[model samples]
Target: MARHVARPDPRAHWVLLLLGLVTLLAALSFHGLVSAVGGGSGPDQAPASPAPRAVTTGGPVLRLDGPTPVSRRLPARTLALTFDDGPDPRWTPQILDVLRRHHAHATFFVVGSRVDEHPELVRRILAEGHEIGSHTFTHVDLTAAPGWRAGAELSWTRNAIAGVTGREVTLFRPPFSSTTAAMTEAQYEALRNAAGSGHVAVLADRDAKDWQRPGVPAIVKAATPQGGAGAVVLMHDGGGDRGQTVAALDQLLTRLGTQGYTFTTVSAGIGAPDSMVTATTGARLSGTALRWAQTGADWLTSAMNLLLGVALVLGVVRLAVQVACAQRHVRRVRRPRRRLPEVVAPVSVIVPAYNEAANIAATVRSLVASAYPALEVIVVDDGSSDGTADIVERMRLRGVRVIRQANAGKPAALNTGIRAARADLLVLVDGDTVFQPDTVYRLVQGFADPTVGAISGNTKVANRRRLLGRWQHLEYVIGFNLDRRMYDVLECMPTIPGAIGAFRREVLFAVGGVPADTLAEDTDLTMKVLRAGWRVVYEEGAIAWTEAPSSLRQLWRQRYRWCYGTMQAMWKHRHALREPGAGGKLGRRGLPYLAVFQIVLPLAAPAVDVFALYGLLFLPWSQLALAWLGLLLLQAGTAAYALRLDRERFGPLWTLPLQQLVYRQVMYLVVVQSVVTAVVGNRLRWQRMVRTGEAAALVGGAPAR
Candidate 1:
């Protein structure tokens, strides 16, 4: 089981959140109008009630055409509390107790599936005089493909709930709160047409992001509203975990009760009446509209829930991996080497060159000057049309060999060099990368330990004068280094830096050389080595420096490929994830951890995206303002800590927010794309980022003075 960490709410700008109610109302009103006018059946004809209008005081007024809600005038204090998306056995009862204590009536949009398992809860909800609303069968987000499945979902839940309550349910809340103009129109028409005797649709005015697992404070903050306005605060009684939600409601309701607030049922507040009408006809109609509405509503609901399930699974998977791997530690056994070994085995340093014309010479020079005993620098030029390889050839360095090849990509080039290597060990470096004089010595020394099959070097951005470069520097220090340490602890280092990584020649051969099919050869090789029972070690002292992408666009592309490649590698080794380690119980716990923490997390991130936007658009101003302050402080802390780690970089600390604004979403997008690709079985080929000549052109302001 993965450790659960509550994600901070995204409504970071609490002070600026005052307009949420107004925005939500406006959106609701706009949607209502668009649906009603655009081919809607008749004005809501259900038991007498006023026309649906988005209002601050009241929740969504359902305007039905046939057997639809009859729009009638009502007082501002006439607010109906509507909860959607649950029948959570864990939390729904707590919400019920509070409502019963307050003698307040509300509506619960129960999921169909939940009602089937816990029939008593649905019966109790209905028996207690709280109106019941359909939130689809599975609580699926209706926005996904195969939108028609919602009909079955709705019918299933409705029948289950009715079986227990022996009462008909009329209201419907689309899963994910998503309703298209077409779907809404169809749902309204279908509901009224299907209305039997007396059933009405329930809509909400206010929404609390209880589904997101916000803490009790944040939940209360969102649920409480501005207090002055008579409002229907939306809460969930079901779907996933709602423990915090149930607990928060008790506090919110009690506090509000002290302030003399009250709640009412939709039927009672709107004034019960006989028979609903088709909104279009404003006259009694057949049950056809009601059935159509039910069908459409169900399909829509199923689509939404399906999407939500996929998202949830992704998050849970990542969480599982992170938790499982967090405890295991990989022992780092560094061999002591005071001097170079005698008869110095010839070393082949393979540099996979792309368009590195500017830095190729310098990179080659660094390799030539390495203080190793015997070394052979093989620069496999991966079809760089630029003068990169030419410059290396012109240098005529004694031990350096420039091998020109067609543009077969990085993995292929590395494979070529490995096949040709005559040395005992092979060092792979990117063409644009430059290594320190002592890097080879430090890297080779680790091989003295027979278990250390391959070794990774620390990567630092060579140029950090620019803000982007500086931020990248901090990222390497805080993000990469921390990750490396964590992976070292787990004994499953999943990726070796492509800039400079050394491997035993035999180990490379055993893994069938570098996998040519994957975009991330280094990551693929790392997993393969671990799977084959070879241990990977990290050389903290064997540092290599290379240029970092200078702009957000460049960084996005680079990181995007990395993420996509990671997913590909994860897919390749998924079987190993379930394999037991030395014990018969579990083969490799580390693989599972990597899958959950690194591969599965990107999909879960979308919840934060939705929370951020919704909070800005719907949350109360004060709470929104407070949330923003909290977010800012968190960002500030992250920046300060990151900067402290890489104080040598100028703007790394100051650029944290900017990085979140420009870069974070890109990362999220890449993660999302990776998930999509994995599901669709799309193959990712290696695509190198174009190197800017600036890093090489940069003259020393002061080199490690």
Candidate 2:
């Protein structure tokens, strides 16, 4: 029998989720990993080291104090103009266009990492006859940068510029420093370090301070010449908003042109060749690696964006559909039912037990206590080593029979009980499920319609004293019942759970007495009956108390079997999609929905989780938090509505938010694992959770802990 096969391990979902989590983290964490290996900064190129140490000495301590770092002002009437921290796609182009308007050429000192990201910008600079200078990788204040990193900063920028422009650069600018007067001890040290590395320290004679954004007027005033024949004017083409800098550029150019000051590259003013023979082999390799790492981050970020988009779309659709359908269902069920002929048929209740000694006696006793006048309870012991049969015998109750059988599965056990049953109405239940007094009577009411062959009952969780149990309880009420209300109204109700369902003996027998083929005997059997032209409806008023898995591990095993078996049954009956008559109704109304919402939606749900993590790590915390709260709110409202429909209390909804943190992820992954298992053609066995007799008190209406 199908239910007799090997069951899935409860650990399977965790293993699968763990593997998927690792993969997602890998994608999101790619930049960090690469940065760690290469000893570089992230995409934004923030300083790699902590804040610079305080240097008390004030005035510049560079070449002006001597002659190495700073070059003298060009011959009278000359000006060498330079911009720093540039190649920003947003601001750089604006600065370039402004420079173009004046038909002037200037040097742009580019950050190496930024160049790796926007290599074409470097090429554009060279193509425009603009000189390139090294701004150090990541814009670190080289003075305070560690020993291992300082050299790489300058070398990497030179190589990155050369890699794209095919020309080496000798002009260097120590970040946050200028000519002799403006340099500090740290700045002097950094400039000397650059000279040692064969770089000419390019310091400004005038500081535009455009990077400060002290208005266009302020920047123009700062750059105005001191009536000098030559000067090195400082400005910025990149970093933050450069609108003021760009606007101020045209003003400075006109002012300088009026004063007869000519603009030239930093090297020409210093009287050296603008280009060098080569960028070192090490620098080029570092640049290439940075280029590749950036490319990877780009791809991963794009993938995450795509995933988030799809998840958002699907999530919204689901929420809309569920909310709309649930509202309609609530209103419809609230209306009084038309009086129908009372269903007084005697019911034969069948409890199939396999190592369920824990709750067998209580379940049988609950059936015996049903208010229905005529009742016969039959307990089928499916070869339990645990004295389940002995427990039934100890009850010595009337109208109840125990049929001991070999170790066949649940379907076989149910078949045995059905055969031994003497009544026309049959109620099938698991050993762990206990019923209310009027459950059988209310369940059979659905049989009033001659076409209605089976009725599904409301199965509630009895062990909801813990957080996990409470989550399951919510699932039973919202996920299962809300779905049934919608599907039943659509005339395409699919599953009639094993815990509490009723069927006519004739219809049950026609379906081969509970089908032993699939692990989900209830689902397989239900669809078979539907295909056989029998109508199935859910009876929400017929309540059955069943023990829910109290631990995540147990829940994983049970849900895994349920999800996998459901996939198999869906595949087995897929031909219904093409059928013309009764099966056509199922094919048209039922299968597409099951395929989409069940199979497709679940497989893609993990993307929401992946995107959530990405947003936390790369995007803003506010974005991730808002998105999470919005989803949680949607769920909370939906859960509240479901509880109202089920006549359940609102208190359970308190746990709904926390449930998103863990329980929901587990369920999502279980569905994912099921899809993977089905796609790979793996056979899944029926898995049963260990039963505890705690449900006896719950059925007796004991207060929840």
Candidate 3:
């Protein structure tokens, strides 16, 4: 007898949200496994789980079987000879030939890199009648992962397959078949979710144990039907040493054929099948023993998905509001009346250096050359083993003062400079950055209004010729520019960015100088300033160009630090959450905007991801069409905004879909990591960003003011 799966409660929305979060956490943890191994796929013919509904009322098949049981009893006699961790030139073709001779179809769960390396093989697989499944970008296990890494494995794998075969792969077979039942449930749902609204059906039984290199006779013997007629068999053609699999399958097919058996594709046997089982609830039912169980599961899943969706949406809306708040506050500033204050007030420029021997002199030189009349350049050398102070002293830069301090972090260094500042206005610059000739003037322009507490400058990528550099350049242009504009409109500038920013000396003191422990001291200060009801402004023309990471390793480290720091900032300001008038200037505008842009948007991203992967994998033309339409509109809107900003790069814009393959996961990582760090009170000491060969040299080229 088929057992009835217990249903979840209708009001279990919170549970669903928790489940979603758990799934997200699982995805992050299983990232390496998914990337290095693969995820599992649902039955190819299994229609996409219906779109979320208030009460889905179609088929009466309400008996929920455990996933493993469902996979075992799928009413198809055809075998899905799925070989994971492959695209190997040496062995895949041999297996393909054997399948061809028997006129049999199989599924190949291909790794992303292999697909790229051997596109022709992928093309051949698709053309020859075998279905393709994602073995992750590099055969990663998606069951025990968290953050961007998990999302990357799923998304990148899908994208690579799509690129090679032009087919949207819906099924993912996890490598090693290693996920526990609980882990599988979370991972399958998350991958489905990350794929954008698709359901993944995991295989129940493994017939041919090929990964172990069992002898050909053992392989054939294992696959020979032992239980009832219908069964889904698994075989391998990848992940090393498959010659035995090739020989075994040939003999198995011949044996099955001689036994008066016929081979059929999984879909061919099931798609549009005549007989169908309908499970229905009786009309007189008032939450019966069975009815309750059916509705319970539906209710639980629905509530959870809905709540998570709501939380994600709310977070994004908050960020948007924050951006809008910043803009409004900046626009509220009255026009400057007097020219340069006649007897120009002295503005102190603080340069924070820690072993910045290669670039400190240039930074000091830029400050000394600043067109602002009465400017003091204070270089704080934070215990550098290198002659950073010596270089500053050797330059003999006029109006520049060098201060030696112990090896303190950026925030500490900033505080030292702030305390020593002899002027009323203070500007903090990283030692590795350079400023435009008019940077200081522009930074100080916003100080005309007494209500303005701090000013942030426009930051740009100085080196963008390399591929990685171009990618970073595009990121700065689109992400930062959009975020800044939105923040300006919202009125809460998260931080007067440290690269080139100014604050009133008194205002700095009011906010208690720079925060020493937070990785993003700049952001914390900006939030604190807003929480105090003061405004932060952006000087768009005040350009400061800094070197972006030039390689993947450097890029990863830099981003990890940034994401970790941003999480820290969010935690410190979490008091603003839903509190009436809790955020001061930011609460009213900035906090709300940021919640929308940063928090909600990323969470919502999985929705888009689920919808997209569903459409592609299941070939649901209608749903796919709708999702694709939405995606097109989103791109159109983003592109228009990018164009309006004059920062449009045709290549990045064109690769939007592909970029999303990796981009969404990156955002998800930031979100997941932030949440975890918040809960654990994770503390991170600042790690200096690595600057590779040319990147190191290019730091010297930034134009001194």
Candidate 4:
């Protein structure tokens, strides 16, 4: 009894995958790993506005919320050292070492995202008797950002700090801020909002400009205060190479200490209380979650990038191997050599039909018109409801016979046809395929060498008037035929396509007459013949035209069956890897090639598109476009060469790019579904395509009366 096969809908799995991808991209944007939508910049480059003289000249710390806005200057002979855009793993530690050696205390205004990345550094700053302040998350300019963004930035930084050290900070420094005298109105207004939230805005009075990486002397000169007046010096520990900042800080600290200058935290310099406070439990929990979430997103993005790179290398390597091997095969075929004896042996052609009434008459007539001297045609109708056998019988073509059987499937029908055949050599043809007059003659010529067990003929897509048809035509020439040449050269040809293939009658019986265990009977039988130690070769001169699916749904079904069946066949012949002789060659070479290029590469192919979308969103478009174009051109060159080898027209090459966008994706999805179905141990039924008589129309073959 046949086991019942269940078709499972995989829509839910795909939906979940899409949602997860979207969530990851959103996380990356939020963490500033990718460019955020509408993200604003700092106020450093903005035009200056009128400023309050007292706040500008008096102090670096200000309180703007009280009825009387006030500013207090640092004590005489004292300096408050502040670093922005940290805590970087590199440079920050070096600067801290210098401060530790000098016994100087300073403040670090940390970006929230970086705080999450290096929480231990934040904790160390607080432990070493230094202060921690908010530089706003992602270092966005509070003055230029939307009102809500300013608040969120400050809040997120506070939460990140609280999560790391169990404390909250009230000291805040807006990114790109400088001396109060240079403040724009937008900067002042942003400060007022911070004051409303109980934040002490800390602006620098002396800009060290070490971020420019100027000489250490320049940074020292800029940071020093004239005479004994106290000042707040600004520098950076992150955002780029900060070698100069670290060196300048060490020298500046020594010079100031010798001048009887005292170093203090930002709050203490102005005689204010400590800005750090214990964080709420809720804040700590929320911030920890946010930190881990960002870390996971970072790891995932790294992994995806690595996989994309590996897939690219594999794809390129496969293309190079195919082209090189194909060229070698072409050279060998074109070289002058002694010709083999002409094969005049009688041949039997087997046509397996199931609901193929639309094309059976034309199929039989084409076979009857073969140029071979002695030929017999057999049509096996496997319980076709459309009277396929009756149509063939009415043709009354000479030496053609029709046999009826219960619908036992294609493999069984082919076996029945093999049992009825009388000739020593046999050719298998699909019911919807139309053969050229010399196809049989050329296909049988391979049998002149008794070592040849089977010969695979070139199969072309006949219905090439439509875009879908043209795409398949290109695939046949470029993907299938080119690969066959390479396989033939390697002496491990895998599949003799059902559209047109010839086999010795004894070789068929020796391989157990078309194994019915797998959906891909052709591939299964071919592998069996190879494992039996008989050589299989490809005859490029024999051409058979067959109809390709015209609609997307039909194409999907047909390809899904093909992919799933091929996998099943591969699994069945897996032992060939360890076996000696020709089977081992198929296992070691042909199977691995199929597994990598056909299965694994297609599985990873979607990553290319995903990264392309990522590049469009966050990377330079010009670079991405050039890279994509280079790959497309490489593929086009390969396709052109394959078409030239097959003697095909270049007209279908125009659809190559569109095929990558649409048809290629469909084929990838088919492989994905087939893999998923196989993993779940689901048996797939044989899927038959609707006959359209397109093959007969293309070959100009008239139906038999």
Best by lDDT: 4
Worst 10 residues of 3 by lDDT: 54-63
Q: How high a TM-score does candidate 2 get?
A: 0.83
Over 26-104, each residue of candidate 2 has an lDDT whose tens digit, in order, gives 7566554323222111122223342223221221212333442343456666766787877889888887888788778
What does candidate 4's lDDT look like per residue over 1-705, in tens digits?
Answer: 999887557686577656755775665455444123121123346445746566666577888888655877788899999999888899789989999999999999888888998999998898899999988878776767898888888888888888889899998888888887677677878988998888988888888877777799999999999988899888888888889889899899899999999998988887778889999998898789878887887776677778878877887887888999888988887786457888988999999999998778877888888899999999999999999999888877899999999999999999999999999999999999988899999999889888999999999888888889889989999899999998898889989999999999999999899999999999999999999999999889899988889899899999999999999999999999998888999999999998987798787666556656666777788998898799889889999999999887777888988998999888987888899889878788888898777776755642221
Clash total of candidate 1? 74
Ranking by lDDT: 4, 2, 1, 3
| Tens digit per residue, CA lDDT, model 1, 387-470 | 778898899999888888999888888988988788989999987777778888887777766777888887878777776776
Against the reference, the lDDT scores of all candidates come to 0.64, 0.77, 0.63, 0.85
After the best TM-score superposition of candidate 4, give how far the Cα of residue 581 lies from its true spot, in angstroms.
1.2
Candidate 2 steric clashes: 3
Q: RMSD, model 2, all Cα superposed?
A: 5.8
Model 2 residue runs over 4 Å out of place are 1-23, 26-76, 88-91, 98-103, 111-117, 134-163, 166-203, 211-215, 240-244, 275-289, 509-513, 580-607, 618-626, 679-681, 702-705
Q: Which stretches of candidate 4 lie over 4 Å from their true place?
A: 1-10, 27-58, 63-70, 147-152, 192-198, 337-339, 701-705
Tens digits of per-residue lDDT for model 3 on 1-705? Answer: 999998545335436655875564443333323224432332233224432231122111111223321222334344545666678787889988988998887777678656655678887887887777666665544555665766766666665655554455556555545212212344444445444523243342444666667699998887766543544566766666788888898998888777655565444434423111221233113213222332343354455457656764664564455346444544554444555353257899999988887667666766777788889988998998878899889888778889998887788889999999999998889887777678888778777777788888888776666555655665666677656766665565676777888889998898788987677788888888777767787777687877677666566556667767776787788776554432554655665555655666565666545533433543457876785567556655555555455344455455455455665476565565555555555565577865332323433354211
Candidate number with greatest TM-score: 4
